[model samples]
Target: MIRTVVLDIGETLTRDDRYWASWGDWLGIPRHTLSALVGAVVVHGRDNADAIRLLRPDIDISAEYAAREAAGLGERLDETDLYEDVRPALAALRAAGVRVVIAGNQSARMGELLRALALPADLVVTSGEWGVAKPARAFFEHVLAVSECAAEATLYVGDHPVNDIHPARAAGLRTAHLRRGPWGHWWADDPAVRVAADWSINSLAELPDIVKAQE
Candidate 1:
């Protein structure tokens, strides 16, 4: 009976179209160049961090993210930045007596940012807070422990097939692939990857129905 729904933040609940472009500007690279590099990384099945390291070997990722945050990169998020389906889906799930959690591979300020946006999540967890990132078994273990929910009774929804679906499925949690962001649209046709998810949804509007069906 899925008692908890764990959701990814970027490109899942929120649309961050300007995020990479802002990063490119900060790194002194052309936006298009950075975009192509990111696309290449996805195509080659490499981590996004690898692409940044390949482009700027001297760049310190942690420091860069710190600087970005200091400069207010992820600080303030407007309501329009969120997907139209996000609020409705969250409301429906909450009304159905399901615990909604927002968990993601983001900086420590992620929870604050979501709060600023007034996102409807019962709890928010981030990699920075947990000291581990996604695709890591320890992270999921932490989530399960914190939520106090059995793995089989949890559902994880995210856009990344590798980071979200595969790892969550391996952890015995049902996985939902949101087919809108880069990971979803780019890897949608890949049989090996897409097969990992229990559900593929283009919008969060479909999520409430899917969750009810799971029950």
Candidate 2:
């Protein structure tokens, strides 16, 4: 039985559609260009703050992104209330005796983001706070150790293949790739990794049944 559901924050819990789109729209650049710019920044060994600074020299772009993310802007763009399904899903999991924790990389704005979105989770673990990027065994093992959840009974739901699925699987945790965008097929087929999600639904509304079935 699944005793805990560990979630990834940025792409899985909160959609980046508006955040990315806003950045692209503000710079008058296509989305792909924005993606390329971000890639270049990462390639150049720039951290998140540095990447944002290089993107828009005129404004404190990193702070702006942080504020907007704290306020949950993506749902607004989709004409939906932010955290519409998040709170309810979390409550359901809690009701079903499943521990809910957020394992992600974020800056100091994490509390604000969860408050703005009204997401309830038992713990929040981040690479920035932990001083390590994920896809490393330490990331998964650390969270499991801290949360006191068995690696085999803890499931991680995320959007990224390598950073999320691969590492979590290696840690003996089940994985659910929340597929719902252009990057969905990035690892739809890979032998080194398994894509058989315990559940493969898009919206968070489908999570309750998914978790219950694991028991």
Candidate 3:
């Protein structure tokens, strides 16, 4: 039985358009230029941060992130940033007596912003708060701890295949690949994603039914 549902943030919950656009402005790069580079990096299986590194080869990512924050141009989260189906899907899961957890590779500040929005979930956390990121064993260990359920009984949903699908499946949690964002669309048809995720969906609205069916 799927007793818990854990979701990733970017693209799965919120679109990264504002985040990237802000970064582009901070870096003094045109929006289209940075976006194309980001897509190129994703296609090559590189980290999204690498897109910045490609444009500014000597930039220190963490330092630049801090600089952005110090300048008051850091991570911005508001209601409109989230996908339309997120709230409804999370609510349905909770109504069905399922534990909902939101955990993703986001900064601690972003975590605070997310919590401020008071999303419909039992727990909300991020890799930055845990001091570890996804595709790492420690990250999944944190997830399992927060889930309070056997890995097999938890369903992890995210857009990225490598970070969400492969690792979550390997860690023994059931996974759903959400085809809603750049990474999602890029890798959705990959055989690896198909093999890794227990379910592949295009919308969060489908999640409650998926959970119910498993039960």
Candidate 4:
């Protein structure tokens, strides 16, 4: 049985609109411009943060982030930022006795923001807090360590193939590629993603049935 469902944050559980928009505002650029740059960056297999660097090659993202926070323009998340299916799917999984964990590449404050929302989860953590991010073997090792279960029993889900499916699978965890976000859709049909992922799902709502099938 799939005992644990560990999920990524951005574009997996939540819509990234507010996030990119916030960055756009902070950078004093049109939201659409930043959005497009982010798309281009991701499409080229570059980091999403490269979008900002594309605009200002010398910018210190960490410093700018601190400046934003100092100016009261930091990250913020709420119910509206979440996809409609998040609560229902997570609740269903938890009700079915599946452990729900939210772990993703986000800031330390993001962990706080997610906790403030009180989502139905056993743990809500971020790379910023752990000092580790996805796509790294070490990150998956941490995931396995915290799962309280074997990798075979833990299912790691996320929208990004490189950061989620590939690395998690490498770590021996069952991987579910969520085809909900840009990265998901972009790589969904690729043979690499299909091969790396044990399952490719468009929504979290589909997860419960997949878990039940193992019964």
- Counting clashing residue pairs in each candidate, in order, gives 0, 0, 0, 0
lDDT (10s digit) by residue, model 3, range 1-215 = 99999999999999999989998999899999999999999999999999999999999988989888898888889999999999999999999999999999999998999999998999999999999999898999999999999999999999998889899999999999999888999999999889888999999999999988987
Model 1 C-alpha lDDT per residue in residues 30-126, reported as the tens digit of each score: 9888888888898887888776787898989888887887886644467877989999999999898889999888767766777777667788878
After superposition, the stretches of candidate 3 with alpha carbons farther than 4 Å from their true spots are: none
Please state the error at residue 56 of candidate 2 in Å: 10
* Location of the lowest summed lDDT over 10 successive residues in candidate 3: 66-75
Q: Better model by lDDT, 1 or 4?
A: 4
Candidate 2, 103-213: lDDT as tens digits: 776554553445454457777666767766677898888778765678878888876666777788878888887664333344444444355455555666677788777
Query: What TM-score would you give candidate 1 relative to the actual structure?
Result: 0.92
Candidate 3 RMSD computed on C-alpha atoms after optimal superposition onto the true structure: 0.7
Q: Kindly list the per-residue Cα lDDT of model 4 for residues 85-188, writing each as its tens digit.
A: 99999999999999999999998999999999999999999999999888888888888888889999999999998899889999999999999878988889
**On a 0 to 100 scale, what is the lDDT of residue 108 in model 3?**
95
Off by over 4 Å in 2: 25-83, 185-198
Q: For each candidate, what is the lDDT?
A: 0.83, 0.67, 0.94, 0.91
Every model's TM-score: 0.92, 0.69, 0.99, 0.98
True-structure RMSD, every candidate: 1.8, 5.6, 0.7, 0.8
